[model samples]
Target: MKVLVTVKRVPDPETTIRVKSDGSGIETDNIKYVINPFDEIALEEALRIKEKLGAGEVVLVSIGDSVVTEQLRTGLAMGADRAILVGCDQDLDSLAVARILAKIVEDEGPQLVLMGKQAIDDDANQAGQMLAALLGWPQATFASEVVLSDDQQAVKVTREVDGGLETIGFALPGIITSDLRLNEPRYASLPGIMKARKKEIKEVAAADLDADMSPRLTINSLEPPTQKEAGKKVETVEELIGLLHDEAKVI
Candidate 1:
């Protein structure tokens, strides 16, 4: 029943994002950061699973700059027994990120790993899959519901698909990517916050993980989409039809 929950720190959803002046990336200077909303759901799911089992530990893992500790602390306050900071400060693709986590998995053997279906910033749902593939473990993506066997040897996961939900069962040592419908996340209480400060957090360097940073993808640049002006409204249906046939070219 041991669980490892992965989290990420991203700019607060309420914050307005400005593209960098140099066109490299977004300007994050002095911007407030918060736990990724999707990862919050994953943490909630892992907490629930641990609480249900009432016997196993829940470890929260995050790979980012030193600022990511805030996000990890939030998870610790929510009920994670411990935290692991991979401490990869710079930007990394999903593959490298997955490699770092997989190294942590090798060091601390956990039966289950849970993560967000995708990061809000990149919306790239590749980390969990990459980790699972690298570890050669079964993976269930976009999971909404999870049903574990009596002995906790296997898991039946329900995931949302194009039209309906699909259920798949896999053995232990599996990875699952969570969706928004998983569960509601809770804010840490004062007592919980104090307890989090005392919780054990093991910091490891990128070298310790032996993770390669060679990126398979590159970000050319980011720019806003083209803006369109409002079109004049035609009062009569005939006029609208004429406009559609001419300027609009719908006809």
Candidate 2:
């Protein structure tokens, strides 16, 4: 079972985001960066699967610039065998990003592709699905649990939907996007960190993929949202009702 995990370098969730002056995208300068939290769980799941089988390789793949190596190293530290970096400068939509990953899948020829449900920055939950479509393979999104089935040719996946859980049996050579409940990501020990530097990180350029990297949509401009006016304090239920009926026009 050769597992390929797709991870991302996302801005730290705690960082204050500011849209770029030209409105093309968000300003990334000086912001702290980290591996996408959900991708960490996906990596964890991949490691667990490989550990259980006691065989196969866990390959981490990401599409980004030089800084993304640190994020990929996080997966290597957690037990991935190796990594592939598709160096894409600027930003890419989920569609273009998935295309690059699909190329890596062809190069690596992994039996499974694991990734986070969505990256925290864009919240575009489309990469895995797009990759599956691009590869013409089956996909299971929002998978909370995954168990190998009877013959190791299939996987029993339990996914979380609105209000409940759903199960599906998918064949191997598929993609799965993991949710938060999957597992807690392990921290890289000092030794693991040192060893990660030695692990192989194969980098490739976007132009080499023979794909155009153009945005289909253009952003006009971006500005801070208008501040909301403070409402009058209501001391009693009657006052609240009055305010709702008149000032807020709720009633």
Candidate 3:
């Protein structure tokens, strides 16, 4: 069983984000970067699956500039057999990213492709489905649990739906997107970090993938959200009622 896990480099979730000077995008300067939380969960799930099989490889793949290699290394330290960096300097839409991943999937021919349900930065939950569509493979998104068949020919997945959990099954060579409750990600130990430094990470340019890397959407401008005014205290119930009826108007 060969598994491909997709990871992403994103701004630290704890930091405050500010729009760029020209309102084009967020200011990444002086900001810390880390692997997407959901992607980390995906990696953890893939590593667990590989360990259970005891005879398979878990490869980590990321799409971005050289900076993304840091996140890939982190995945390697977490027990990924190898890593691949899709060198794409420009910002790509979810569809374009899926196309690139599909190209790699064609080349690698993994039995399963696991990734996050959405990237926190954009919150676009479309890559996994788009990749499945591009590759003509079955897909199960927002997977809370994944169990391989006894024969290892298929996988049963429990998904987190709107009202309740939905369990579904898919044959091999499919894609599964990890949800938040899938698993807890483990921290890379010192030995693992040292080993990851020695592991080979192959770099492949986006152009080499031969996929259309054009953007289908554009952001005209990014504006900061309006700040709310401070609230005033009402000393009496009658005063509050008067304010609600005259100014607040909720009543």
Candidate 4:
């Protein structure tokens, strides 16, 4: 089994986010970058699957500039066999990203492609589905658990849906978008980090994939959310009801 795990480099969730002065994008200066947490879960799942099989490869792929190599090396340290950096520094929407991934998928011919359900930065949650569509493969999104069938021809995926869990069986050579509960990602040890440093990271230009890199959406501007006003205290339930009915317009 050959598994491809896609990862994303994102601003550290714990770090404070500030908008650029020109309303272009977030202020990246002095901000820390890490692998998307959900994507880390995906990489962990792929590593576990490879370990279970005892004879397979787990390849990590990501799209970004050279800084993204940091996250890719982290994934490698976590046990990915190799890493590929799709050198795309320009802003790419979900569709363009999907197209690039689809091209890589076609070239690599992996039995499974594992990635996060959504990138936290954009929260688009569209790439895996679009890649599946382009590949004409079955998809299991928001997967909390994935188990390979006894025959090794299909995967039983447990998904986290709106109401509850749903299980679906998908044949090999499909795509899976992992959810938060999929698995706890393992940390890279010192020895693992050293080994990862020795591993090769191949870089390919986004245009080399031959996918259309055209931007479908353009961001006009970005602004921070308005600050909330302080709440007022009400002396009586009737007063609260009156406020809700009139000022708040709930009623």
Index of the highest-lDDT prediction: 3
lDDT of 3 by residue, 1-251 (tens): 89999999999999999998799999988899999999999999998998898889999899999999899899999889899999988989999999999999999999999999999988999999999999999999999999999888999999999999999998898999999999999999989999999998999999988999899988899888888999999899999999999998999
> Which ranking of candidates, highest lDDT first?
3, 4, 1, 2
> What would the per-residue lDDT of candidate 4 be over residues 1-251, giving only the tens digit for each residue?
89999999999999999999899999988899899999999999998988888889999989988989999999999888999899988999999999999988988899999989998988999999999998899999999999999777899999999999999997898999999999999999888899999998999999888999899999999998888999999999999999999999989
What are the per-model C-alpha RMSD values against the true structure?
A: 2.2, 2.2, 2.1, 1.9
Clashing pairs in 2: none
Indicate the residue-level lDDT of 56 in model 3: 92
Clashing pairs in 1: none
Stretch of 10 with least lDDT, candidate 2: 211-220
Q: How close is candidate 3 to the true structure, as a TM-score?
A: 0.92
Relative to the true structure, how large is the alpha-carbon lDDT of every model? 0.89, 0.88, 0.93, 0.93
lDDT of model 3, residue 5: 92
Error of 2 at 223 (Å): 3.7
Evaluated at residue 138, the lDDT of candidate 2 is: 94
| Better-scoring candidate (TM-score), 1 or 2 | 1
Residue-by-residue lDDT tens digits, candidate 2, 76-97: 8888989989888867888888
Candidate 4, overall lDDT? 0.93
In angstroms, what RMSD does candidate 2 have relative to the true structure? Answer: 2.2
Tens digits of per-residue lDDT, candidate 1, 85-164, equal 88776779999999998889998899999999998988999999999999999999999899989999999999999999
